[model samples]
Target: MLVAGTTRTAEIEGISAAGADSDLLVHTPSADAEILTYGEPIRAPVVPVSPSGCPTPAVVTRAVRELIGLDVTVVDGGLAEPTGAPTVTVGARPGDDVREQDPVSTAPGVLAAAREFGRAVPDDEVYLAETIPGGTTTAFGVLRALGETPTVSSSLPENPLELKQEVVRDGLTASSLEPGDAAGDPADALRRMGDPVLATITGLLVGLVEGDTAVTLAGGTQLLAAAALARHAGVETTLRLATTSFVAGDESVDLETAARALNVDLTVTDPGFENRDHPAMDAYVAGEAKEGVGMGGALALADAAGVPMEDVRERIVTVYDRLLDGRDPAEPQP
Candidate 1:
C-alpha cells in the first residue's frame, strides 16, 4: 500500500515550475491525489502539467499502480481544494508562505495525528509518497533550519537554486532562526519553517519506526527533508529512498550527499522515457515534472515485480491519451 500526502505552500511561485500556470498550481496536489485514486482528475479536464506540457508524474504512478495492483491511500496534509478520493486529513488548512514565520502553526498537532494515523495502518510494508506544490522550497527551509545546506532539486529543468535559497533565507529570517537554530528540536524546525506535508510525513516515519513494518520514503529532496527531521528527532530506524534518474542525474544538486548525510539507502529508477513518441514523455526526457506522486518508487517496484518498462510506458500513453481527450482510462491496458 502507498500512503501519499498532499499539501500546499504559498512559496510555490518563483521557486517551483510544476503546473502549467500560476492558476493551476494550487490544484496540483488535489488533482494528483484524485488521479491516483480515480483514473483521472475530477476537478479538471486534464491532469496537471508542467509549463512545457509534461504531464504530472501522477500518470507514471497511476500506470505502475494499475500494473502492479498497488493500493493507495490519500492523506490530506493540507489541500487548497478537496480531492474526489477519500482522504485521512491531518491538517485543517493550507500552509501559508514559508517567507512568513510559523508557516505550519499546527505542526505539533498535525504530527501527532499523522503518527496515530500511521500506527493504525495494518500493512507490514508501505510506500510513502507526497503531492505538494512548492514542497521542495519548504523542505529547503526545514533542512536549513536544521543546519543542513541541502541542494534540493526543482520540477523544472533549470534548478532555480538562487530563487530557492532566497525563499529559504526569507523564511528563516521571518521565523527568527539562523541556520541550525532548530537543530536538536526537529518538530520545532517543522513548526517554524516547514509545511503540513513535512510534519505529517516526519510523524508517519517516526510512528512506523516504533513498529516492525518496513517503510520506504518515496520521492526526492522532500522525503529527505522528512527523514532528516525524523532522525534529528532521534528516529534510529534505517530508511530507504526511491527517486528517478532525472533527479539523480541533475547536476545542479547533490542528492547522493544529502542521502548519505541522513544515512538513507537510495534507489534511482529510470522508466526509460527517453525518445518516447508521446508529448508528455518527450517533455519528461527534456527534464520537466521529473518526480512526484511516487512515480520513482512505483517504477522501482514495478521493475522488481518483473514488469517491463515498455509495459509501463504503454500504460502511461494510454492514460495520457485519454486525459488529453477529456476521458477517463476506465481500465488498465494489457
Candidate 2:
C-alpha cells in the first residue's frame, strides 16, 4: 500500500529548507508525490519536482511496477489535492502542524478507516510506503510522546536537528504533553502530535496483523514511529522497516538504534546511486530527498524478486530523464 498524506507543518517557513523549487517544496507533501508514484502526469499535468534534480518517488515506483510487477494501492490519509489514481480517503482535514495545534483532529476516524482498509487488503504480504512532507518533525514529536529520545532524518543535505527539536518542543508544550506522558497510549500520542498518515499506518499495521498479513513499512523515521505505535498497540505479526541507505547512513539520526528499541526489524536498500551518472541519483548521495514514497522498499523487493540492480538503476534514470526533460521516454533523445 502506498499511503500519501500532507501535514501543514511543511508550510512553516524553514521547516523544509531544501527542494528544487519553492513550488516543488510545497507540492512534495501535496498530491504531487502520489502523481509521481503513478509514473505519469495525472491530476497535476506535470512531473513532481524535487530539489535533488534527479530521483523522485515516481522513478522508483515506476521501476518496481515495471520490473517486479508489484501492484500499487494508494491510500489517502489527507491530501491537499485528490490523486488521479484511485485512493481510499481516510481523513477529512489535512493535519495541522503540531507546533501550532493538535495535529490529528480526526485520529479515531482515520484509524478506523485504516483498520478497514487493512482488513480489506487481499495480499498476504504488503509493502507499505508514504509521502508526507515535514514528516520527520512529526515523527520526532510522536517518538518523544512515546518516551523515546529520537534523532530523526531529513531531506536536506544537513539534517536540521535543532530546528526540528524546537518545533517538537513547541508542539509538546502546546499540547501539554510532557515526555513519556503518552507512552502507554500510542493512539493518544498520535492524536497529540502525529499526522493522519502516521495514525493511519499505525492502525493499518495493527489491523493487518489481526488479519494474518505480514507487512513491511517502507520509509524512514516516520515509519519507525508507526512501528513503535504498533508495538504499543500489541501488534505481533511479521513486520520490518525498510528504507534507503542514505537514511541508514545519516549521522543525524540513529534509525537502526530506534528500530532495535522498538523491536522492529530494519533493512536498507543500497541502490548504488552514488555510482550512477545522474544528478538526481547523485543528489541522493549528497543527502537530498533521501527517501520517500517507498523507494527503498520497492527497490529491495525488486532485488529480492531477482531484478538486476543495474537494470533497476537504468530504469530509474530513464524515468527521471523523461520527467526532467518533459518528453516521453519513447521519443528519441536530441
Best by TM-score: 1
Q: Which stretches of candidate 2 lie over 4 Å from their true place?
A: 17-23, 29-37, 52-54, 326-334
lDDT of 2: 0.74
Q: Model 2: which ten-residue window has the lowest total lDDT?
A: 325-334
Q: For model 1, what is the alpha-carbon lDDT of residue 214?
A: 90
State TM-scores per candidate. 0.94, 0.92
Candidate 1, 1-334: lDDT as tens digits: 3334333454366666667776667777887887888878886433688766678898999988889999888887777776787888776357788887777888889888888778777789888888787888888889899998776788888888888888888888999999999997887898888888878888788877766669998788888888999888898767999999988888887889988888999999998988478875887788776788888899999999999999999999887876667433222112
Model 1, 306: alpha-carbon shift in Å?
Answer: 0.5
- The Cα error of candidate 1 at residue 177, in Å, is 0.6
Deviation in Å, model 1, residue 162 alpha carbon: 0.6
